[model samples]
Target: MSKQRPNLYYTELDLFILLSKIGLRRKLKPSERRVLVKVYYSEYATPVVPVLITNGKIRLCGDYKLTLNNNLIVDEHSLSTSEELFNGLAEGDKFTKIDLRNAYLNWKVRDEDQHLLTFNTHKGHYNSTRLMFDLNGPPAKWQRKIENILKGIPGVYYL
Candidate 1:
């Protein structure tokens, strides 16, 4: 019997093509996270949380559960249930699905709060200017904000 493994590496062209595929869908600000190539002595950087590309979509994620998620406070805002969304829909209403690529990172972190998100890596120390995934607070915060935004609109709904 013979065993074979699929190639799990990506070339630069692959990355360029991947980015091109979803670039328009995610025409986000280039200033998502500042590339801090060096660390200051006074800055307290968290343990290294490497950039994770989950799939072909080039969906980047952060794994701060071990390093940062613990000390942070979780927002207690209630998230909407499937039942609630269905109940709110009327006969004449239509559903519009929007896909946000860099989901949590759409929200920028505050200047003061950005310091807490600093991470140390072999390459260099870095900090996030925008919200990163695996952070405890964004989902609830975003849900609350979405609810508030849709609340004022006449026919818009969020899922």
Candidate 2:
């Protein structure tokens, strides 16, 4: 009988691709070239967390509650309620659902704020150029960004 192996390694190429998609770039300032965050991995769920190699150990990065409490600003805006969602649809109206894969990664973190999300590894130090998953403020930030974009569009209303 042959045994199947579960993949354990999250290669550097994977990190590179994610960073590329997130538009990550190197900070040229020597003073800024310090590890601001540490990467870690988790297998507590079905899909294993992304792993990064650092000093021969796996590390994961994310602290939602802490990030939210310290870094993000709360807004007055609220998500649509069930009633409001249903009210938006009328008879004969077509409903469409759009799923944006890696939606959080699509949004970029401001250069000034990027340092807040910096992380370090055996390889080097880097900062996030885009919003990362499990960050504290991404949901609110995403809502704000979408709302802003919708404001500029014609015939689009957000409640």
Candidate 3:
């Protein structure tokens, strides 16, 4: 019988690519960015160690276990939407569509409830908890805002 073993060695770039592939990538705060890069470089041969420390987890394939809450927020596009809602079909109408850049990022999740956005890694688990939106139930204010917008539409509309 013959026995074979797999090689687990990795290069610096390999670690970077691995982290990126699993969605473990993050846009660090201005100050944290420098530190993060240094941490990655300083521990190049064993980047995973620092990665687990800095990110507080060892994610695999970038899949994070997201726990949805009742106070969830979601993009309008994610909801059941109709093209006619914003389509300017009237004759001689100048249609204008504005995209909200990084709209979800503009939202702030309360510090107390940030733990909802966490992931389990190969080593342990970590989370930012600062959710930009909810995927489950929604806030009352958001529901009212949508309802108000729909009610205020001057023409016939259906969702």
Q: Which candidate number has the best lDDT?
A: 1
Query: Model 2, 1-159: lDDT tens per residue?
Result: 013222222335666556544333443344323323323542211111234566654334533333323434554557778786566554435555566434767675676656555443334434656665665556776777777877765334454
lDDT of 1: 0.55
User: For each candidate, what is the lDDT?
Assistant: 0.55, 0.48, 0.37
Report lDDT (Cα) of residue 20, candidate 3. 67
Taking the tens digit of each residue's C-alpha lDDT, what string does model 1 give over 20-81? 45432353454532523244541445553224355633444434665456666688886667
Provide TM-scores for the models: 0.63, 0.48, 0.38
Instruction: State in Å the error of residue 144, model 1.
Output: 0.4
- TM-score between model 2 and native: 0.48
Off by over 4 Å in 2: 1-60, 64-71, 122-124, 151-159
C-alpha RMSD by candidate, in order = 11.4, 13.5, 13.0
